[model samples]
Target: MPLSSAPISAPIARQGDGADPYAWLQARDEAEVLDYLKAENAWQEQQLADQAGLRETLFQEIKARILETDLSLPSPWGPYLYYTRTTAGDEYPRHYRCPRPVDGSHEADEAREQLLLDPNELADGGFLSLGAFSISPDHQRLAYSLDTSGEEVYRLFVKDLDSGQIHSLPFEDCDGSMTWANDSQTLFFAELDDTHRPYKLYRHRLGEEAAHEVFCEPDGRFFLSCLRSSSERQLILQLGSKTTGEVWVLDAEQPQQPFTCLAPRVEGHEYDVDHGLLEGVWTWFIRSNQDGINFALYHAPQTDHSVPTRADWQPLVAHSDTVMLDGVTFNARAITLSLREGGLPVIEVRPQGLPAYRVQLPDAAYSLYVQDSLEFDSDRIRLRYQSLNRPAQVRQLLLDSGEQRVLKQTPVLGEFDADAYVSQRLWATAADGTQVPISLVMRRDRQGLPAPLYLYGYGAYGASLDPWFSHARLSLLDRGVAFAIAHVRGGGELGEAWYRAGKQEHKHNTFDDFIACAEHLIAQGVTRAEQLVISGGSAGGLLIGAVLNQRPELFKAAIAEVPFVDVLNTMLDPDLPLTVTEYDEWGNPQEPEVHARIKGYAPYENVRAQAYPATLVIAGYNDSRVQYWEAAKWVAKLRTHKTDDNLLLLKTELDAGHGGMSGRYQGLRDVALEYGFVFKVLGLAL
Candidate 1:
């Protein structure tokens, strides 16, 4: 293993316990920092040297389960059908389109498919992430954005489909969002600021020499996002912070006109709007949290170019205390909503003149995602559904007849049986008597008693941690390992109130809830403390870090990927990417009370000189969110302070950012490596 040769010294960051000894790692550009990261990577490779075969087997298992040569369900747009194809041996999918069959068939013939963009060809064995892919309304041109360095600074480009001529735009940084005007000649995009916030909105015309700036959000806490309404009659620009939001709408027909505000910004109010035809009148449908913690749907009719105010807004869907209105989709013939009730997703559809009904799900704890249709009046809506034990299935629902058909089910290629695995929803009692949900999946046949279990969690930003199928997890499940997810309080699984209970000064609930779930799992004979393995990434990594500090002996091994461990220091620095915006989620540490509250659980500040479980942490050197230094400093501090000599390792991806390696193949490989580390520490055979 590599050891730091530089003289240890304290720096600016003052930990609650003492001065941070590893604060020097924050200087990312220093040669010493780079060398240390590389050394740590090499050390991690050596530490898992004997697991090469296990890693390979795990990788192969993951690869075999996935059908390499496949294509996504085609989506109908203007005059063409668009979809993506993934050929065997390719690291990325190829975008393609075909003319819609004149016979009105939902799917066009494969022979008529036209190639659009191939990431595999564009990447040329390097990293490439597509930020935006927008086809103009005229269908004569395509506008897209690319991020080549994984830093998320995308460059915009316009391509003439017929002439095959591509024109590059001058903007080097974008927020990965683009919208076209009714004229199709005017294109709108958002530019990122120095802090990586999408603060500027601009308009660029085809065949024009200059771009015009439309709007600029001066407040660091608020970022901008723009999109065309479903009616294609309104251009919407939304400025949002963590706890507050304000929406502005422009007349799509008059692209040069300024936008009008629907409501003034309120400190605690957040709302989103979309255009639709309500009762034959063009209307703005909004989902707002003004009336209740869970959002409610409201609509305001727009008879002309005159914008409507909050006074014109009328209730459409009343806010419910038990259900959360996650999102709303507007269509010509129907209005669908994404809702959550009892910690499960519910799709509520209100078709014209007909009553509303919730879509039935296959499992109690499954994942649901809606793919908004391009055609506003399309009668069918596409949705993707999956559970821990089931492969993802794409289904199309007919709004007119209340009927649905399966479009595609992600093929599990290798030998597999759906009945082999069982999924259950369980509840764990938190220390404060709150019931925390746990989604579990395990093989029906057990080879041993109280087998090894892999527990995962992420409890921040009101983001619910939903269960979904993972082909790679089969490697562990087939080897007698059970997997579970702790839907703790910080997550919005139950609703906005649940999320509020886990953040800010109440952040301790997130850690306590996680610990409670672990204890409950052990008490129920699902797994023993000595055979349990916990894992989380990003904010969830923060959860794991805090829980480990409070109760390290609860698990056998743990994995923290891109952890936000240095919370105190990061929040204190307002210039960081999300620091200012994060003040709403985690209170501003500038206030003494807030500082003490954060220091109470901010992982890096709270890490003690106590015994810790075998741990492996993975970080991305180029991550804009949760910078690499947090993980590096945390590991360095643990190495110096921990009393036990338990195995501790760090792996940094030199070329990737927060999401890790870009390609699908590389993503699976990363998972295989992480699982190999778990197998090595848990004494499991490949």
Candidate 2:
């Protein structure tokens, strides 16, 4: 591997107004900015040139563990059973369908498969993401959205399954979300503004020349989304901000009628509604957080075609201080409540009039995600379960008996053995005496007490970072590397209170909590400071930057992927896509107090002239969520300020966006590159 970097260029200054010297880098059309990015890319490639063999070895090791030609477990929907399959050398999965058994049974043995959609065909050797995949209620038509430029804007297309014919809408900035009315001829879709916010809702008739705007959320703080209720009786529209929301519903059968408000917007109150006869009445079952930090379940009658507020809601499940009611799903036979208790995921089932029971998984620390029940009236519910050392399994849970049968368990090929790994839960006390949870996994054959460990964290947006199994992670584990995830505050794992404690004015808690976790690992003999590596992406990348600035001596190296480091500048620019929408989460930086708080720890604003650790920064040229310039500008500032001969490299993906490289094979290559970086810095052999 290349030893260290040579001198790099300083950031380009924006001539006049702004406080940022690298503000000019955000100008996409500037040749000078492009040249700078290209130069950095060239430098990064040159630095890693000697690791080509190691990269390939890691890539092949990961590939060897995956079953190349495999098909997903078939799911029955209407008259068909749907599944996706990958060929030995295909870049993407091919979706296929077959008719279910004639006697209304979920049998696929006699079914003949029919090819429907192949992303490989649509991608044409470039990036392609399916934003929306909706089949009409009548099951006669299909509407799908595609974004091939990695820019996040998608175009909608409709297909006639019977005739195998297709046509596209004229929209270029569609939000890639659409729902069909009961009539099947009418479809509702959200439209994205120039800032990439889904601000307007539109209605289109199957054969119409144009779609007309039906509703527009003028407030940049809220985004509009719509979906047909499971009852298939109403089309529900929600306008949601980070902390406040409003709900509206229209009769699915009456497509031209205006949507009636279910609840008016109230600050500090967030709730979601669904159409169901939960109490043997046509009611709206709501998962709301009005009286408690952890949400509760309530049901309100559809009273005389009039809007009902919180006063009309009757509690079905009272809010509990220990349990966070994350979501509620209803069907004829059951009402499922997704919850998080004691920092772990739980699935609760309430059969019509029967007692509630939890669907238990075997693992001590694993993630449980409930899938949408394709057959809503059926007695069985489907869910997926996995952990850091376990491959995911799709299971069919029998609601009546509380027994689950595995429909399909993801296969890990070659010499993979689940019993050869150990997954453990550890706790680290934060500066404020709060115990942060850490999920860790390593090989059972390890001979050393302090192994080379990789610690990952993300503490923002109430988004939990689950300890998921990675086929590529085995490449590190087999070589005696351990991986752990710090479940710090700002994540939903421990409930709303945990999330609130790590966001806005309390954002510093996130960084401090992460540092505590790193120190705890060393103190417990899990890993030595020099053998430890830290990493996070996006907001988590912000965590990496802040902690590194505060205690650069705590880690051997770091990786920031498509990081959101220029927080103060980006959050202050209200014109940015997610800036205004995220006010409740990050606080409005325009306010004096909020501005000062953000500026205090915003990574780009606080870079100091000190010895820094070896770092690898990844960026995407077309990322709409976190702009590419954030990474570029931060790297430029770091290079100019840091007084170290350590490795600092920035690699930009020219063809992809926020999620980095697309396509399965290409994604593996990306992981290989990252693994190579870790190996190089830690001085590990391939």
TM-score of each: 0.97, 0.96
lDDT of 1 by residue, 349-407 (tens): 99998988878776879999787565898888988899999998988888867687888
Instruction: Point out the worst 10-residue segment of candidate 1 by lDDT.
Output: 6-15
Clashing pairs in 2: none
Clash count (model 1, backbone only): 0
Per-residue lDDT tens digits for candidate 2, residues 368-407, read 8887476767788789889999998889888877888988
* Clashes in predicted model 2: 0
Candidate 2 is scored at a TM of 0.96
TM-score of candidate 1 relative to the true fold: 0.97
RMSD of each: 2.9, 2.7
